[model samples]
Target chain A: MHVPVLKQGDYLIASVQSVLSDADLVQLRDDLAERVGQFRSRGVIIDVTVLDVIDSFATRTLRAVAHMLKLRGAETVIVGIQPDVAFAMVQLGLTLEGVGTALDLEEGLAYLDRLARKPVKHGK
Target chain B: MENNEACVSINSAADIVTARQKGRALALELGFDGSDLTLIATAISEVARNIVNHAKSGEIVVSPMNHSNKRGILVVARDEGPGIKDIAKAMQYGYSTNKGLGVGLPGAKWLMDEFDIESKVGKGTTVTMKKWLH
Candidate 1:
């Protein structure tokens, strides 16, 4: 069972738990992407804290979420990445690239707040 | 010899984690980077998952090797079960007989420098993978 920890505001929080397999990682990304479209103005914070391992599939899914949110005029920040897990990700040569990574829920919210204020840079 | 002295076994998922931890430790002890250790762990996890789902019981052997001018980590995944019939097809990504996403053996082979698969229809399968550190 995989649950995504999400934050709506500084204090408002919600958990989206799903039984995910390798394929479901992709599904979850799509689901989150759709959610971003519906709640772009509110911004979004996704808690991937429960994830201990980041494989190619998971990385791709996360990348998709990041792109989708960006398209919907919103910003997404990932939080609670464990150290050993980060080390594993580094070893895999996996890159978050455009996605933001935070230390915890508080940090993630803070990161999102900061992004909300920054002027959008158009890739023209 | 330093090569023969390195060995370990994993039966369950917990054992898989322990085995991978030990494998990474060995990789570090032999001067490999943490990145290599991650790939090794992923590869081992895939094989161990296969053991649990298919073989039900198997043993993994991790040994150090001096291959050419670089140090290589040799992993032998042995299992006693219904062996693989088509080695070529099995090596293809997304070609799992079981309902896997099909990124286990093929992915492991891609991550390593050398991969060899030997199996008999009714016997078992032995996969040997070696990752060379430069």
Candidate 2:
């Protein structure tokens, strides 16, 4: 099953709608990285509203994806995390510390836009 | 211990997803709220994934239970594979044998109300957990 990743201007939006296995997530990571390079996108917003559960593996995969995007000059914002998923994440102590998160897709896009407008920080 | 139980085999990643789905549906039928349902499902996913990644194969059984004046759900995941040598270390956060995040066992334990594990090296392992309705 292919996850549709739509490109909007300088941002890419990918919505996760199905139960994703480790292999699927690995595929997504590769796909997103390739797409970001091809589109020269500056930001990505991953929507996970349709996902009922986000296990430790999935959380780690998201963090990895975000790190990979950052290395490629693209910022990633995860959006639409359900409240229960959030609760479980906290309970499990899988904080996803380095990943950015937003309440919804609109908010996530806004966040990316803000980041784009900000002046890049020099070596610090 | 109610007779309404659902069981699924876990041999691959897809089977882990199936187990979580069935577990979630059962939790919903037992009147678990949205948050509780998600918690239960996530807990199931953690253990089921352990089976697929660590044990290589296993089975998950979810059942409804009634005790004293409380109702709850029970999940039992068992595998006949290389059992954990140090069950204590396996239960520690960030202690994985396969370079994983190592949150599967401990995280599942925290998500549910009760958690138990029995394992013997070169034999097998079984995890039993329960979450009572609130």
Cα error, candidate 1, residue B70 (Å): 2.6
Interface RMSD of each: 5.9, 0.9
Each model's C-alpha lDDT? 0.67, 0.91
Please tell me how candidate 2 rates in CAPRI terms: medium
Q: Which ten residues in a row have the lowest lDDT in candidate 1 chain B?
A: B3-12
| Candidate 1 lDDT for residue A60 | 61
The CA-based lDDT of model 1 is what? 0.67
**What would the per-residue lDDT of candidate 2 be over residues A22-111, giving only the tens digit for each residue?**
788888899999999999899999999988889999999999999999999999999999888899899889877888899999999899
Per-residue lDDT tens digits for candidate 2, residues B1-134, read: 34469999999998988899999998988989998999999999999999998889989999999888999999999999899999989999999988889999999999999999999888889999999998
* Candidate 1 CAPRI-style tier: incorrect
**Which regions in candidate 2 have their CA more than 4 angstroms from the true location?**
A118-124, B1-3
Lowest lDDT sum, 10 consecutive residues, model 2 chain B, at B1-10
lDDT of 2 at B103: 96
